[model samples]
Target: MKAWLILLGAMGACAMLTLAYQAGEGVAEHRCEVARAVAKDAARSEAERRDGESAAGTAQLHDNLGTQLPAMEAEAHAATERIRTIYVEAPVSGVCTRPDGVQAELDAARARANAAAARGL
Candidate 1:
Protein backbone atom coordinates (compact mmCIF):
# COMPACT_ATOMS: atom_id res chain seq x y z
CA MET A 1 0.00 0.00 0.00
CA LYS A 2 2.81 2.40 0.84
CA ALA A 3 4.52 1.70 -2.46
CA TRP A 4 1.26 2.25 -4.37
CA LEU A 5 0.69 5.61 -2.61
CA ILE A 6 4.24 6.76 -3.40
CA LEU A 7 3.84 5.84 -7.09
CA LEU A 8 0.53 7.71 -7.30
CA GLY A 9 2.06 10.82 -5.73
CA ALA A 10 4.96 10.77 -8.24
CA MET A 11 2.58 10.60 -11.17
CA GLY A 12 0.57 13.52 -9.86
CA ALA A 13 3.68 15.62 -9.41
CA CYS A 14 4.81 14.89 -12.94
CA ALA A 15 1.42 15.81 -14.32
CA MET A 16 1.43 19.14 -12.37
CA LEU A 17 4.88 19.97 -13.65
CA THR A 18 3.82 19.33 -17.23
CA LEU A 19 0.74 21.55 -16.82
CA ALA A 20 2.82 24.34 -15.29
CA TYR A 21 5.26 24.23 -18.18
CA GLN A 22 2.48 24.43 -20.73
CA ALA A 23 0.86 27.33 -18.89
CA GLY A 24 4.16 29.23 -18.84
CA GLU A 25 4.54 28.77 -22.57
CA GLY A 26 0.98 30.01 -23.17
CA VAL A 27 1.61 33.08 -21.00
CA ALA A 28 4.80 33.91 -22.90
CA GLU A 29 3.01 33.64 -26.24
CA HIS A 30 0.20 35.93 -25.02
CA ARG A 31 2.74 38.51 -23.84
CA CYS A 32 4.44 38.59 -27.24
CA GLU A 33 1.13 38.99 -29.02
CA VAL A 34 0.17 41.89 -26.75
CA ALA A 35 3.49 43.58 -27.34
CA ARG A 36 3.08 43.32 -31.10
CA ALA A 37 -0.44 44.76 -30.90
CA VAL A 38 0.79 47.69 -28.82
CA ALA A 39 3.60 48.44 -31.23
CA LYS A 40 1.25 48.34 -34.21
CA ASP A 41 -1.16 50.72 -32.50
CA ALA A 42 1.62 53.15 -31.69
CA ALA A 43 2.86 53.19 -35.26
CA ARG A 44 -0.64 53.75 -36.59
CA SER A 45 -1.19 56.65 -34.22
CA GLU A 46 2.06 58.30 -35.28
CA ALA A 47 1.18 57.96 -38.95
CA GLU A 48 -2.24 59.50 -38.33
CA ARG A 49 -0.70 62.40 -36.48
CA ARG A 50 1.70 63.07 -39.35
CA ASP A 51 -1.12 62.89 -41.85
CA GLY A 52 -3.20 65.35 -39.82
CA GLU A 53 -0.31 67.77 -39.59
CA SER A 54 0.33 67.58 -43.33
CA ALA A 55 -3.34 68.17 -44.06
CA ALA A 56 -3.41 71.21 -41.81
CA GLY A 57 -0.36 72.67 -43.52
CA THR A 58 -1.91 72.10 -46.92
CA ALA A 59 -5.11 73.81 -45.79
CA GLN A 60 -3.16 76.80 -44.54
CA LEU A 61 -1.35 77.10 -47.86
CA HIS A 62 -4.66 77.07 -49.71
CA ASP A 63 -6.06 79.74 -47.41
CA ASN A 64 -2.98 81.91 -47.91
CA LEU A 65 -3.27 81.54 -51.67
CA GLY A 66 -6.92 82.49 -51.54
CA THR A 67 -6.20 85.61 -49.52
CA GLN A 68 -3.30 86.77 -51.69
CA LEU A 69 -4.71 85.91 -55.09
CA PRO A 70 -6.50 89.23 -55.58
CA ALA A 71 -3.49 91.27 -54.57
CA MET A 72 -1.26 89.21 -56.83
CA GLU A 73 -3.65 89.74 -59.71
CA ALA A 74 -3.60 93.49 -59.11
CA GLU A 75 0.16 93.50 -59.16
CA ALA A 76 0.20 91.49 -62.38
CA HIS A 77 -2.18 94.00 -63.99
CA ALA A 78 -0.02 96.92 -62.93
CA ALA A 79 3.07 95.19 -64.30
CA THR A 80 1.37 94.46 -67.63
CA GLU A 81 0.18 98.03 -68.04
CA ARG A 82 3.60 99.42 -67.16
CA ILE A 83 5.24 97.09 -69.68
CA ARG A 84 2.76 98.09 -72.38
CA THR A 85 3.30 101.75 -71.72
CA ILE A 86 7.08 101.25 -71.93
CA TYR A 87 6.70 99.37 -75.18
CA VAL A 88 4.62 102.15 -76.71
CA GLU A 89 6.78 105.00 -75.47
CA ALA A 90 10.20 103.42 -76.15
CA PRO A 91 10.36 104.49 -79.83
CA VAL A 92 9.13 108.00 -79.00
CA SER A 93 11.72 108.32 -76.26
CA GLY A 94 14.44 106.93 -78.63
CA VAL A 95 15.73 104.52 -76.00
CA CYS A 96 14.84 101.27 -77.74
CA THR A 97 18.20 99.76 -78.68
CA ARG A 98 16.70 96.36 -79.67
CA PRO A 99 13.20 96.47 -81.11
CA ASP A 100 12.92 92.68 -81.22
CA GLY A 101 13.74 92.29 -77.56
CA VAL A 102 11.31 95.02 -76.69
CA GLN A 103 8.62 93.39 -78.81
CA ALA A 104 9.17 90.03 -77.14
CA GLU A 105 8.89 91.63 -73.73
CA LEU A 106 5.69 93.36 -74.74
CA ASP A 107 4.23 90.09 -76.00
CA ALA A 108 5.01 88.35 -72.74
CA ALA A 109 3.45 91.18 -70.78
CA ARG A 110 0.29 91.13 -72.93
CA ALA A 111 -0.01 87.38 -72.51
CA ARG A 112 0.21 87.71 -68.78
CA ALA A 113 -2.39 90.45 -68.82
CA ASN A 114 -4.73 88.42 -70.97
CA ALA A 115 -4.36 85.43 -68.74
CA ALA A 116 -5.11 87.42 -65.62
CA ALA A 117 -8.08 89.13 -67.25
CA ALA A 118 -9.50 85.84 -68.47
CA ARG A 119 -9.29 84.45 -64.96
CA GLY A 120 -11.33 87.45 -63.73
CA LEU A 121 -8.39 88.66 -61.69
Candidate 2:
Protein backbone atom coordinates (compact mmCIF):
# COMPACT_ATOMS: atom_id res chain seq x y z
CA MET A 1 0.00 0.00 0.00
CA LYS A 2 2.80 2.42 0.83
CA ALA A 3 4.59 1.68 -2.42
CA TRP A 4 1.36 2.14 -4.38
CA LEU A 5 0.80 5.52 -2.73
CA ILE A 6 4.36 6.61 -3.57
CA LEU A 7 3.93 5.53 -7.16
CA LEU A 8 0.70 7.48 -7.50
CA GLY A 9 2.24 10.58 -6.03
CA ALA A 10 5.20 10.39 -8.37
CA MET A 11 2.95 10.02 -11.38
CA GLY A 12 0.87 12.97 -10.30
CA ALA A 13 3.93 15.11 -9.91
CA CYS A 14 5.13 14.19 -13.39
CA ALA A 15 1.81 15.01 -14.91
CA MET A 16 1.73 18.36 -13.22
CA LEU A 17 5.20 19.23 -14.47
CA THR A 18 4.27 18.33 -18.01
CA LEU A 19 1.10 20.36 -17.80
CA ALA A 20 3.01 23.35 -16.49
CA TYR A 21 5.50 23.19 -19.32
CA GLN A 22 2.79 22.94 -21.92
CA ALA A 23 0.89 25.81 -20.36
CA GLY A 24 3.99 27.96 -20.35
CA GLU A 25 4.71 27.16 -23.98
CA GLY A 26 1.19 27.93 -25.02
CA VAL A 27 1.22 31.26 -23.23
CA ALA A 28 4.61 32.17 -24.61
CA GLU A 29 3.44 31.48 -28.13
CA HIS A 30 0.51 33.85 -27.74
CA ARG A 31 2.87 36.56 -26.60
CA CYS A 32 5.27 35.93 -29.46
CA GLU A 33 2.44 36.32 -31.96
CA VAL A 34 1.52 39.77 -30.70
CA ALA A 35 5.08 41.00 -30.38
CA ARG A 36 6.06 39.64 -33.77
CA ALA A 37 3.11 41.35 -35.36
CA VAL A 38 3.84 44.69 -33.73
CA ALA A 39 7.54 44.82 -34.53
CA LYS A 40 7.11 43.37 -37.98
CA ASP A 41 4.10 45.53 -38.81
CA ALA A 42 5.77 48.75 -37.91
CA ALA A 43 8.44 47.84 -40.40
CA ARG A 44 5.86 46.49 -42.80
CA SER A 45 3.66 49.56 -42.66
CA GLU A 46 6.61 51.84 -43.20
CA ALA A 47 7.67 49.78 -46.18
CA GLU A 48 4.20 49.86 -47.67
CA ARG A 49 3.88 53.58 -47.13
CA ARG A 50 7.26 54.17 -48.64
CA ASP A 51 6.31 52.06 -51.61
CA GLY A 52 3.12 54.05 -51.96
CA GLU A 53 5.04 57.29 -52.01
CA SER A 54 7.47 58.23 -54.66
CA ALA A 55 11.12 58.37 -53.66
CA ALA A 56 11.06 62.09 -54.21
CA GLY A 57 8.06 62.71 -51.94
CA THR A 58 8.44 60.53 -48.83
CA ALA A 59 11.28 61.99 -46.82
CA GLN A 60 9.04 64.17 -44.71
CA LEU A 61 6.57 61.36 -44.21
CA HIS A 62 9.38 59.09 -43.09
CA ASP A 63 10.28 61.52 -40.36
CA ASN A 64 6.65 61.79 -39.39
CA LEU A 65 6.23 58.15 -38.31
CA GLY A 66 8.03 59.05 -35.11
CA THR A 67 4.72 60.21 -33.73
CA GLN A 68 2.85 57.03 -34.58
CA LEU A 69 5.05 53.95 -34.77
CA PRO A 70 6.15 53.93 -31.14
CA ALA A 71 2.70 53.35 -29.76
CA MET A 72 2.05 50.35 -31.95
CA GLU A 73 5.45 48.92 -31.22
CA ALA A 74 4.97 49.42 -27.50
CA GLU A 75 1.65 47.63 -27.56
CA ALA A 76 3.18 44.75 -29.45
CA HIS A 77 6.12 44.51 -27.07
CA ALA A 78 3.81 44.59 -24.06
CA ALA A 79 1.84 41.69 -25.44
CA THR A 80 5.01 39.70 -25.78
CA GLU A 81 5.98 40.49 -22.22
CA ARG A 82 2.71 39.13 -20.86
CA ILE A 83 3.95 35.59 -21.29
CA ARG A 84 5.09 34.18 -17.96
CA THR A 85 7.81 32.17 -19.63
CA ILE A 86 11.30 32.76 -18.42
CA TYR A 87 14.71 31.66 -19.49
CA VAL A 88 16.95 30.88 -16.54
CA GLU A 89 14.18 32.41 -14.47
CA ALA A 90 14.90 35.91 -15.71
CA PRO A 91 12.13 38.48 -15.60
CA VAL A 92 12.30 38.82 -19.36
CA SER A 93 12.84 36.00 -21.78
CA GLY A 94 15.06 35.86 -24.84
CA VAL A 95 11.97 35.31 -26.98
CA CYS A 96 11.02 38.92 -26.25
CA THR A 97 14.42 40.50 -26.54
CA ARG A 98 14.35 40.72 -30.31
CA PRO A 99 11.01 42.47 -30.39
CA ASP A 100 12.29 45.15 -28.04
CA GLY A 101 15.27 45.79 -30.26
CA VAL A 102 13.26 45.51 -33.43
CA GLN A 103 10.88 48.30 -32.46
CA ALA A 104 13.61 50.90 -32.33
CA GLU A 105 15.55 49.60 -35.27
CA LEU A 106 12.47 49.22 -37.41
CA ASP A 107 11.31 52.74 -36.63
CA ALA A 108 14.71 54.20 -37.43
CA ALA A 109 15.11 52.12 -40.55
CA ARG A 110 11.69 53.13 -41.76
CA ALA A 111 12.57 56.73 -41.21
CA ARG A 112 15.76 56.42 -43.22
CA ALA A 113 14.10 54.39 -45.92
CA ASN A 114 11.27 56.83 -46.19
CA ALA A 115 13.65 59.76 -46.30
CA ALA A 116 15.74 58.11 -48.95
CA ALA A 117 12.65 57.29 -50.96
CA ALA A 118 11.50 60.88 -50.82
CA ARG A 119 14.92 61.85 -52.05
CA GLY A 120 14.43 59.52 -55.00
CA LEU A 121 16.52 56.63 -53.79
Candidate 3:
Protein backbone atom coordinates (compact mmCIF):
# COMPACT_ATOMS: atom_id res chain seq x y z
CA MET A 1 0.00 0.00 0.00
CA LYS A 2 2.84 2.44 0.81
CA ALA A 3 4.54 1.78 -2.55
CA TRP A 4 1.31 2.43 -4.42
CA LEU A 5 0.88 5.75 -2.61
CA ILE A 6 4.49 6.81 -3.48
CA LEU A 7 3.95 6.00 -7.18
CA LEU A 8 0.72 8.03 -7.29
CA GLY A 9 2.41 11.04 -5.67
CA ALA A 10 5.24 10.93 -8.24
CA MET A 11 2.72 10.90 -11.11
CA GLY A 12 0.83 13.89 -9.68
CA ALA A 13 4.04 15.93 -9.33
CA CYS A 14 4.96 15.20 -12.96
CA ALA A 15 1.48 16.29 -14.09
CA MET A 16 1.78 19.58 -12.25
CA LEU A 17 5.22 20.24 -13.76
CA THR A 18 3.81 19.61 -17.24
CA LEU A 19 1.03 22.11 -16.63
CA ALA A 20 3.52 24.74 -15.41
CA TYR A 21 5.75 24.27 -18.47
CA GLN A 22 2.73 24.70 -20.81
CA ALA A 23 1.73 27.92 -19.01
CA GLY A 24 5.26 29.30 -19.36
CA GLU A 25 5.25 28.53 -23.06
CA GLY A 26 1.92 30.37 -23.45
CA VAL A 27 3.29 33.46 -21.74
CA ALA A 28 6.40 33.50 -23.95
CA GLU A 29 4.29 33.29 -27.12
CA HIS A 30 2.12 36.18 -25.97
CA ARG A 31 5.17 38.38 -25.31
CA CYS A 32 6.58 37.62 -28.77
CA GLU A 33 3.29 38.62 -30.40
CA VAL A 34 3.20 41.90 -28.49
CA ALA A 35 6.78 42.71 -29.48
CA ARG A 36 6.01 42.08 -33.14
CA ALA A 37 3.04 44.45 -33.02
CA VAL A 38 5.09 47.20 -31.42
CA ALA A 39 7.81 46.84 -34.03
CA LYS A 40 5.26 47.09 -36.83
CA ASP A 41 3.82 50.25 -35.34
CA ALA A 42 7.26 51.84 -35.13
CA ALA A 43 8.01 51.05 -38.77
CA ARG A 44 4.69 52.48 -39.91
CA SER A 45 5.26 55.67 -37.97
CA GLU A 46 8.69 56.18 -39.55
CA ALA A 47 7.32 55.74 -43.05
CA GLU A 48 4.61 58.30 -42.42
CA ARG A 49 7.14 60.83 -41.18
CA ARG A 50 9.33 60.43 -44.24
CA ASP A 51 6.34 60.82 -46.53
CA GLY A 52 5.32 64.04 -44.79
CA GLU A 53 8.80 65.48 -45.18
CA SER A 54 8.86 64.64 -48.88
CA ALA A 55 5.50 66.32 -49.41
CA ALA A 56 6.68 69.50 -47.71
CA GLY A 57 9.80 69.63 -49.84
CA THR A 58 7.71 69.21 -52.99
CA ALA A 59 5.39 72.02 -51.96
CA GLN A 60 8.30 74.38 -51.33
CA LEU A 61 9.72 73.65 -54.77
CA HIS A 62 6.41 74.43 -56.40
CA ASP A 63 6.18 77.72 -54.52
CA ASN A 64 9.65 78.74 -55.59
CA LEU A 65 8.89 77.98 -59.22
CA GLY A 66 5.64 79.92 -59.05
CA THR A 67 7.44 83.01 -57.79
CA GLN A 68 10.16 82.84 -60.43
CA LEU A 69 8.04 82.10 -63.51
CA PRO A 70 6.90 85.65 -64.35
CA ALA A 71 10.45 87.02 -64.34
CA MET A 72 11.57 84.24 -66.64
CA GLU A 73 8.66 84.84 -69.01
CA ALA A 74 9.43 88.59 -69.19
CA GLU A 75 13.06 87.89 -69.99
CA ALA A 76 12.01 85.54 -72.76
CA HIS A 77 9.65 88.15 -74.23
CA ALA A 78 12.41 90.80 -74.28
CA ALA A 79 14.78 88.41 -76.01
CA THR A 80 12.12 87.64 -78.61
CA GLU A 81 11.53 91.33 -79.24
CA ARG A 82 15.25 91.97 -79.71
CA ILE A 83 15.45 89.08 -82.16
CA ARG A 84 12.51 90.53 -84.19
CA THR A 85 14.19 93.96 -84.43
CA ILE A 86 17.52 92.62 -85.79
CA TYR A 87 17.91 93.07 -89.59
CA VAL A 88 19.96 90.63 -91.64
CA GLU A 89 21.69 91.64 -94.89
CA ALA A 90 20.52 89.88 -98.09
CA PRO A 91 22.86 87.49 -99.87
CA VAL A 92 24.92 89.07 -102.61
CA SER A 93 24.34 86.07 -104.93
CA GLY A 94 21.53 83.53 -105.28
CA VAL A 95 23.70 80.99 -103.45
CA CYS A 96 23.79 81.52 -99.65
CA THR A 97 26.89 81.08 -97.48
CA ARG A 98 26.85 80.05 -93.85
CA PRO A 99 26.36 82.97 -91.46
CA ASP A 100 29.40 84.16 -89.47
CA GLY A 101 29.70 83.31 -85.70
CA VAL A 102 27.10 80.51 -85.95
CA GLN A 103 29.68 77.88 -85.14
CA ALA A 104 31.03 79.89 -82.14
CA GLU A 105 27.49 80.40 -80.80
CA LEU A 106 26.78 76.67 -81.12
CA ASP A 107 30.01 75.85 -79.29
CA ALA A 108 29.16 78.23 -76.45
CA ALA A 109 25.69 76.77 -76.11
CA ARG A 110 27.11 73.27 -76.00
CA ALA A 111 29.61 74.30 -73.30
CA ARG A 112 26.83 75.76 -71.21
CA ALA A 113 24.77 72.59 -71.53
CA ASN A 114 27.78 70.49 -70.54
CA ALA A 115 28.39 72.68 -67.50
CA ALA A 116 24.77 72.39 -66.46
CA ALA A 117 24.85 68.60 -66.86
CA ALA A 118 28.07 68.37 -64.83
CA ARG A 119 26.43 70.35 -62.07
CA GLY A 120 23.42 67.97 -62.12
CA LEU A 121 21.06 70.73 -63.30
Identify the leading candidate in terms of TM-score.
3
Across 1-121, the per-residue lDDT of candidate 3 in tens digits comes to: 9999999999999999999999999999999999999999999999999999999999998999899998999999998767644422233354655478865776688789889999999
> What root-mean-square deviation over C-alphas does model 2 reach?
31.8
TM-score of every model versus the real structure: 0.53, 0.42, 0.54
The best candidate by lDDT is: 1
lDDT of 1 by residue, 1-121 (tens): 9999999999999999999999999999999999999999999999999999999999999999999998999999999889867755555555546656776786788789989999999
lDDT of 1 at 45: 100
**Model 2, C-alpha of 17: deviation from truth (Å):** 0.5
List where candidate 3 sits over 4 angstroms from the true fold.
69-96, 99-121
TM-score of 1: 0.53
* RMSD after CA superposition, every candidate: 6.1, 31.8, 10.2
In candidate 2, what are the lDDT values of residues 1-121, reduced to their tens digit?
9999999999999999999999999999999999999999899999988787776467666766777789889988876666523431243555546545665676688689879999998
